[model samples]
Target chain A: MSEKQLHEDQFYITGLKENNTSVIQAIYKKFVPKVIQHIKNNNGSEAEAQDVVQEVLITIYQQATEKKLQLTCPFDAYFFLLCKRKWLNELKKSSQKEVTFLNENVSKDESLQEMVFQTETFSEKQALFDLMFQQLGEKCKEVLRLSFVTKSMEEVAVKLGVTYAYVRKKKSLCTGQLTQLIRESVHYQSLKNK
Target chain B: MQEEMYFAFEQYLGNEMNLEDRAAFEKKLLEDTYWKESFELYQQTHQFLKTKFSGETAAFKQNLKQIALENQSNKNSSKIVPMYSKWFAVAATVVLFCSIWFFMQSNEPKYVEYNQHEKAYFTARSEGVAILKEAQDAFNTKAYESAVGYFEQIPQANRNEEINLYYAIALLEVNKFEQAETLLQAIKSGNSVYKEKAIWYLGLSKLKQKDYSSCKQLLEVLPESADDYNKAQEILEKL
Candidate 1:
């Protein structure tokens, strides 16, 4: 796997990481036309296409940073899949009239399929974690938040008026508690099994 | 998980445990796959938090907004201003109708009428004034060959936009089209007083070269504030 050559689309990912406006603009100018046409052909308005494109782009950026996303396929195919998935999800949530894009042919590219699967799982895992984090007790949330933000248990302890030992113990317990909450959740098991 | 075991896991992962304790933790991990999985999740969560909630998140969002702003700026080429007064709105509608009607009546535009170069004059002081004056007078008198020869004599280290502008125009006058186009492209890409003029002349150069499509494209994008925008647009509409 490591013998595989890096795709030229890596330039776009690097550009996104560095927030180069020209590269981002180039991505839109080059790759977005096909996505927009596809949306319009399926009865979506230009406004909806724009919003979908924007959301999909932001997701790519977020996943890139959070998961160190790699492009094993051409960026266009991966981006199209993401936008299509997001639009399909939207169609399901809203009672929007049926979109016919399900019949559209995607390339039989295994690497692309693997990447799409990883991205979808990563997205769900992120959403599940965020939701589960909110379900943590205030104390657990505070300790974990402070420890992560501060990067030092000593500082967190001082900020929260606790002993160094207490901070260390509390940080572990809070993280452990958070993990427990996640493991006990129904979504966590499905995620793990996936 | 027991508090002691969780604390041991934290200390082991955090690298705060003593070497003996670290060995003990490793021994426990080999025996207990559940702890290994738990540690893996803990490390992933740690990484996720670092990315999702770190200081760079704000910058990332800000950059996205900047890109969005840049994207929208292109789409903002045609903007509709709110005309609140009834008379003002009616007047605007009438003007729009008149322009559309006017455009429909016009014949195919040609570039020859708009391609004529205005005479150029330049000034300089100190050591450069002699050659600068010679070039300027030569250019003024339509001796393009001697104008280019004299202009090329000045040492070319500085980023003087005015000099570059004159030099480029001289180059164009003498049929040194490639050199002239290079200078015009530089000026167009730079922040300078001659930027718009460079664009106009670049278009004219292409027009002279009979590259009608690019000439029309460039002329169509000249902003209203540019010196020759109206003429460019006129030539553009005709083309």
Candidate 2:
């Protein structure tokens, strides 16, 4: 990504933290086109490209929101790698016998392939997290995601159109709820017993 | 911490406790092993919840987009109007026709007088430019609503199709659907490069209003060359 694009992504991530849809749209407008082109060049159709782009953006959104993801590499390379790997996985899962030129090109991107390997290895942890989330109440899940993943309490407040105090209180309540849920989870209980 | 203190502990975990209260809470947490253990549990739960919730959010957004796509395709293939009750449709039509009749009867004399009066003339050349400038400035500042408002203020006569396109986009940003539709209607399709965007938004406006059939119809006509054409087609299908 260019410095300008990097700055835009940073601003977008900040907005997402706050739950600002417009900022998210701006970010979408900036990167989605390039990502789509890259996907198409890699043998994916427009629909596939759209899905890949959305997933990549969502991954970025989630990481930035939860981990307070600081970009060490330019977002372009990192984002491209994630999407490329996801597409490759899809192709592999489909059991295609013949490799297309685009697939070959994607395979050639060694850095991206490495990133994918590093990230994909965490599928087990992700599955666990997904189960825990599913057990949470809808409101609790929403509040926690808003607080940790998106990072914009102000935007969340505005979206919810509730007072800042209410947003804070709700977030705390949701976190507490999740904590209770995790404690009661079968996996956690089994781990404790072990 | 007592059960009653859990709420306070929750606040503390979120860093919402006042400075003095936070300091006192931290001290208590450090001094009391039970409180310290509880806090650690809370921290772990919080971290777990964060990851879980993020994953769920990502899934939800992805699902919403998929739904949109599915709906569009369904609309194109079937053209099935989900049945509204006959009685409801009859009642709506009766109310609409009666209201239009009543409006026409009441406004007939006034319409004649208004038509006879000197046509008001105002040059929008300068004003349109100024408003366009303001809209761009507001967009740059991320003041989406303000940008929409300024864009709307540009006179339709003086505004080029490009300006109208931007105006519709601004209205979309602010979720002002009716205004966007009105502006979009005035811009001729053949000359405007943004015709596809206009059709897409028009369909979206109808979708927002739950006028699924109209949305499907408009979306069906959206040029395949448009950026969102496939997405639009998908939504139309679902509708």
Candidate 3:
């Protein structure tokens, strides 16, 4: 996040954040073919390859939005690595048989590795947080949802027909309660240990 | 005790604490590992909630899904066409040769024997942009003039080797000989998967223009690595 220079490919991230059509089309045209080939050569179908590419792009969009991701390497290298890893993981999850992968053109650049690591971690944590958040009580869910969505404590209080102080207290307690729920989960514990 | 601590957590985050209380809270956070971790998790949970409820997430996802669907349909359509036509070409060649093998062997090879160009597939590459779909449709239907018109709409920078090859073929079909040869020569000089195909098409253009000596010269140099080297040799013998 410090003085490391941003690559020229940062336009892809910004275009994703803004949901630019031409940029997305450009990404598909320029980068998706090699990934499809890699997947097809390794006992995967074109449909599976398409899903992997789409899922990776969505994860990248989420990471870019939530974490303000900056690219230090070529987008091609970063994106291909992410898709290849995701496809391999998918293969492992679906089968118990030992899978020998085709020789991949993996980049060993330190910054690219570091960037992939960060994005993967971010996706995992976000998934866990979403799961825990869904387990909160109905009342707590309502309070937190309205508080964040309306983005104003006073408005939320009026909508809920409660006092400002009550909404304020509930917002804090509900968030704290959600955090406590996450901390006590086995998934969170494993993530923290890792 | 826990409620008060959580209250203090909220107050500290909201910037509602006095200077002295804020100082105490900061010191406690530094010294107390459990409190610091809880506070950090609390902040992250808040950020997650903020983003989850934001307007952009749903809109972005919907747009992405739409784009993916369009791309999928385009891929399915474009993929099926070339594969089907290629197999059809092979089958037609087999059927025709089986019925007339003795008669055709003695006659001079006609240009029609080798004119089964694979159908153009530009939609997937163009991704529904520009005039690629129109060009593909026109080329597949043998409307070479219209195909040439649509191909000319593509900007120079957007024209890759495949696009140029297809465009040059359309030009040759419509008898725009000089322009077609110039483009085919440029493609032949460049390094790409389309290079060999470009050379083959250049030879075909010469054949169409009745320059059999030049066509013979071009076909003679078709490398063994080319997919159409056998076809080139067949044409070379007849020429």
Candidate 4:
């Protein structure tokens, strides 16, 4: 992966990272119509199309900004595949009648399929991590959020009215508890092995 | 692994570990592959939580949502836009019909006499081109054709809104109405510095073209903050 050259369409990823409005507008204008049409023809409305497209863009934005997600395929194929998969998943959740799928070309492209799999996996892991983090107790939650966000054990300790040493130990313990909780979850096991 | 071992990982990461303990930890990591994997997972989780909960996340999400909304509106736009532009886009069309009806009845305060073109003294920031000054001067002096000539020579490569706006106005004056309208439409539809001006000028261009229905629709969308808002309102009232 390191040796693989980034596709020119990496501009879309960089554009998303920089929060360039023009690029965002271009994505919606250029690539979103087929996603909308696919959704609308298959048990969806204009409103649902809006939500799916927004969610897909947000996922890409999150991965791009947080994980430094790099695109090695054409953005159109990668983005369309993500939207298509997400909308199909949504349909399954709602238990709607399955409409005939569009874009067989998506699965035919090996590079697009690989890139799409990476983003899907990243999105799933991100969601699972957020869910597992929330299950932590209130004290653990505050300690973890504060430690990670503030990044200063001394400052966190001061804010929490505790000794710096206590903060360090509690910080590690809270995250340790989180790890233990994730390890215990069946969902985590499936995700881990996958 | 014991819970206390996690603190050792944290301490090592925090650069608080003494040399001997650090060396021991490294040896242990190499010796125990499972523990190495767990440590890496913990490290990944730690970094993920840090960024996911950061203060910037909410604002970034909101910005993305707004951009999506604007794009969605642009996509389905025919007579109406969705989201915030909806009310105005529809209202503009409604106002168009009303103004057309009013135009047929009252011959008072004519649209043509109402607008004595304001001498645009504003020197818009454009790429440093010598002819831009002459264009501005020619436009101010009402030498519309020559202004059109100079403004047309300006590089359109950058999609510069200010240049487009001035060029469009010159296009309108030279009776190249269709070209002017297209340029104004592009500028008005996108997020540009000249958006409000583009809308107002589009209305004026339509009015000059004797298409009152189109004129009223465009005029109604000229926000109150626009320079021509009062004039637009007066024209609407008279129509």
Top TM-score: which candidate number?
4
lDDT of each residue in A22-79, candidate 1, tens digit only: 8888987788778877787877877787788877776677777866777878888888
Q: What is the DockQ for all candidates, taken in turn?
A: 0.28, 0.15, 0.35, 0.37
* CAPRI verdict (incorrect, acceptable, medium, high) for model 4: acceptable
State model 3's lDDT: 0.85
lDDT of 2 by residue, A35-128 (tens): 6677677667778877776766555555555554444344456666677667776777777633353543344654445444444433323445
Which candidate's lDDT is highest? 3
Window of ten residues with lowest summed lDDT in model 1 chain B = B75-84
Q: In model 4, what lDDT does residue A15 have?
A: 84
Give the per-residue lDDT digits (tens) of candidate 2, residues B5-96. 55677677667778899899889888989777667766656665665556556554755475436544654455444454566689899999
Candidate 4 on A1-194: residue-level lDDT in tens? 54667889999988877777788778877898888987898888889988988888877877886676878789998988788789888877877567567664446766777788878887887888888899999999998888877857899999999999998999888887887777788887777865
CAPRI class of candidate 3 = acceptable
Spell out the clash pairs found in candidate 3: none
Please state the error at residue A13 of candidate 4 in Å. 1.5
lDDT of 1 by residue, B1-239 (tens): 46876787688778898889889888878888888888777766666656666666667667766766566556554343344366678999999999997778555454456646666655744357778888878888878899889878888774277778878887886779999999889999999988999999988888778787988888877889999988888777667
Clashing pairs in 1: B109-B238
- Give the winner by lDDT: 1 or 2: 1
TM-scores for all candidates? 0.58, 0.37, 0.58, 0.60
Better by TM-score, candidate 2 or 1: 1
